[model samples]
Target: MHADTFGTFDDTLASGPRRTPLHALHLRRGARMVPFSGYDMPLHYPAGLLKEHLHTRAGAGLFDVSHMGQIALHADDPADAARALEALIPADILGLRSGRQRYGLLTDAAGGIRDDLMVARFGDRLVLVSYTTLRAPETGADL
Candidate 1:
């Protein structure tokens, strides 16, 4: 598998890398650690990459994605939040039904994609999930 599929890394943090909630459990399972998106994440376990991949394909696997970003958008009307979000990303936010989720992208002025994100429509709000690395300033600035 490609390394990018594992996760992206950002090594520019001044306070060193942060740890996920499963950090200790990963260590206990003999996982090899790597820096990913400002967080210390597991690269592989004692079973190794290939074995883990095979096992996952054959049965099941659980991933720790707590390092990803989650943002909740709330407005007086849920449609208002949807309309606001549609101004930034290329998605049919207004058309999305409640309890539904849609994949979308954040693009720059020149139409270059900045990041991939998921927008979920709840009863009273829209919840966005994005990559931790690029969600800080750019996405925050736009919203």
Candidate 2:
């Protein structure tokens, strides 16, 4: 069967579900695509989830998470930006040095995790990346 049978390839416009840069490659490799967040994401390959999981457990796996949210926080002082972010998440953003990254959790007022994220400190800014379902605009607005 054709790979297109796995998912529709209607990613020609800017308004609907967005396609990652690797969309075509995924189709060629028999990735079953599904709508995720606002993007067309691969659910699995032709190998099936169980076999793929076992294969990865036995060795390694490459995940395509290009559809995840990425928000960049910039300020006159990077430390200031980090401090601002520190108020929201549980990570020590202020202690994150340049060229370093840390895993963090976005928590509710009661200390429940709302989302998991990765914070990376560049020289001039801190970039926050959220998981697949978290959109950049929503996460940025929350911060």
Candidate 3:
């Protein structure tokens, strides 16, 4: 309900003053915010991205990737999920080991590309996440 939400950007509706519960917490903890994809996102805290990336590369960064969508399936076993997955994507996703990720491309029945994305098996379910990219979803049909 802040006043800045009503502001116009190039005569179009732009993102307004929205904050996550952690947003206030980050601000309280001296976090810096930046505009990314029309949203006020936290770019860095007292520690910068280079340092954070180095920490992740060296030890652990504990990034806040809550923006990502997480999914899990429980139809059958992992092999079943892989079997269901290979029907759509061109990659041999079934070959992926547990906790491993693989990249694949989506092609039409005629082998025309739609987009490329990654598929990974975390524990029991095959998780898929993509934004504004071509990813072959489960079409529920025999390939």
Candidate 4:
């Protein structure tokens, strides 16, 4: 679809791009590689976005999410961990059941978003997949 978040150049084909865990698989599948978030992510494969979207909706598609930061929080009890996390975030982490995951935002005390994270509850730990670092509101000066 849109290419704004995709790589910057085709001329840098000879230049090395950061690879992900699925880089080899993407090449084998004819994926169009693009620089994204400091990684060479696949923009689309031979199937293209439409076909990929359809197939993913109908079945499954392997995605490279290695660009995200992952962290694990462990406690003697899962509820303890959830409570600790809820203290920092406004999310209802305590409401999550084992084997369940939910999307939530990590907000600052002033309500500014620090980051968006996916939290999954396991036995006695929470696995957090953070999308990115804090995104401060853009100032007009940057424009």
Quick one: best TM-score, which candidate?
4
Clashes of each: 0, 0, 0, 0
**Candidate 2 per-residue lDDT over residues 94-124, each given as its tens digit:** 8887888888887777988777777877776
Q: Give all candidate RMSDs, comma-separated.
A: 7.4, 9.1, 9.6, 9.4
lDDT of each: 0.72, 0.70, 0.53, 0.62
Query: Would you list the rank order by lDDT, best first?
Result: 1, 2, 4, 3
Rank ordering of all candidates by TM-score, starting from the highest: 4, 1, 2, 3
Residue lDDT tens for model 1, 68-101: 7666675667777777778778889899887888
Which run of 10 residues does model 3 get worst, by summed lDDT?
1-10
What TM-score quantifies how close candidate 3 is to the native fold? 0.52
TM-score of 4: 0.73
Highest-scoring model, lDDT: 1
In the predicted model 1, the residue pairs found to clash are none
Error of 2 at 83 (Å): 2.0
Runs of candidate 4 exceeding 4 Å displacement: 1-16, 133-143
Error at 24, model 3, angstroms: 3.6
lDDT of 4: 0.62
lDDT of 3 at 40: 57
Model 4 agreement with the true structure over 1-143: per-residue lDDT tens digits: 10012122233444565676778988998989898755788899886789889999999977676655555665666677677668656789888877888887776668877677677776655444344412212111110
**Which candidate model has the greater lDDT, 2 or 3?**
2
